[model samples]
Structure formats: structure tokens, C-alpha cells
Target: MAELKRKVLTLSSGKQIRLYGNSVAISRSLEIGEGYAPNILSGNNEQPGNTSAGVINPYKLTPDELMELADFNIQLWMDLKANIRRFGVSSPRIFTGESGKQPTETTGNKKTGLSSRQQATE
Candidate 1:
């Protein structure tokens, strides 16, 4: 059997935790339901508003709803990744943008952790 992918995260309290990438857990928890696709909130106004006055806005998540969804998703992802030893926390943002390096765009092997571009360059 192939070994599961793993990651180590350091908490704000100076404690470290290990997480595993479990395929089954991730699929079960993170899979989107049928006919429901949540759009990522973006700054670009691609869909221009109607110029005429009195146009009702379409359905959208309120600020609270957006925050709740974001927090839920982040927590769900962490739980799925660390299925074997669950670590529940709402502070996944600690890893966000902390590293100055730009995120790699290339797809990587989940088992080997080697990106296609990295393999090609090697």
C-alpha cells in the first residue's frame, strides 16, 4: 500500500501537529453536493451591474454567510487531511501567505509530492 501524504503544522501556541492526506475522508467531507457550486469571491467585477435604477440584486451570501462558509470549508479540509488524528481548529489562516514564496502552479503527484515541472527540471 502506498503511504499517505503528510504535513506538519505549527500552532500559535508553539505546538506542532501532524496531518495526513486521506483520500476517502477528503472525498466524503469535501465533495460538493449536486447542483450547488459556490463561486470564489473575487475582486474583479466581471458581471457588470444594470445601469437602470431599481434593479434588485441577485442571491448572494451576506458577509456573515461568506465568513461562515469560508471557516467551515477550511476546517473541513483540515479534518479530512488529518482524518487519522483529528485536529479541529479555526485558524488555518496561519498558513496563508506566511511564506513569501509564490505558490507553485504546476500539478504534483499526491503520493510522491513532486510537481510535473519539478520532475521535468530534475
Candidate 2:
């Protein structure tokens, strides 16, 4: 599979902006993989176009943080359902996780278990 390319935009104040595009077609001959390239030459103009003035910083979060954010988002959706239920809006059921029985050994394995060792020593 072809990797996506990261587009770079240079602002007038010398700040650089990086973005990833899904795909870019350059005729039927040449194709480039996705990544952040420092130098992007202009096609016709001598200078590159400046970045937009009001661009904001993108959100960066770890996997655990993202999961917590998703949980909050689901809660917000559930709260909003009260307003739209009269118009046939249904609250979607969201499952956060599952519960399972704790594993336990019944025979000789139980006596040889780590918990048994702690109890025997005590």
C-alpha cells in the first residue's frame, strides 16, 4: 500500500505547518509517498504562498487520553438525546467494556498457586 504524504505550508512569519493528505494525482507517470518534506518548491511563482492567519494548533493525545475523551463524547450524546427524542431521535447504546469471571484453579494447581504460597509462608 502507498503511504500518505504530509503537506507542508510555510507562513509569512516563518512558522511551518504540516498536514497529511489522503492522495494527490500527478499525471499517470509519477507518484510520491506520504511524509513531511521540508522544502516544497513552487511551480510558477518565485515565492511560496503564505499560510492562513487564523490556523489553530492541532490536538495531540495519547491512546488512553483519547479513550477517555470518547467516553465523555458518548456521555454528551446521551445528554443530547433528551432534546431530540420527540422528533424520533433514539439514544444509541454505547458499551464501554466487558466483565469476565476471574480465573481460579480447583485441583493441585490451586495449592501451588502464588496466593497459596503467600498464605503458607505467613
Best by lDDT: 1
The whole-model C-alpha lDDT of candidate 1 against the native structure comes to 0.47
- Which prediction has the highest TM-score against the true structure? 1
> In terms of TM-score, how similar is model 1 to the real structure?
0.28
| Tens-digit lDDT string for candidate 1 (1-122) | 22333454455666755554222222223432232222344333334784544422245658898789668767765644553343234433222232322234578989779999888877
Residue 1 miss distance in model 1 (angstroms): 26
Give the lowest summed-lDDT range of ten residues in model 1.
Answer: 93-102
Clashing pairs in 1: none
**TM, every model:** 0.28, 0.22
lDDT per residue (tens digit) for residues 1-122 in model 2: 22333465555666655557432322111122343332322123334674433322245456677689667645544534432453333322221112312123222336555465465566
Model 1: lDDT of residue 94:
21
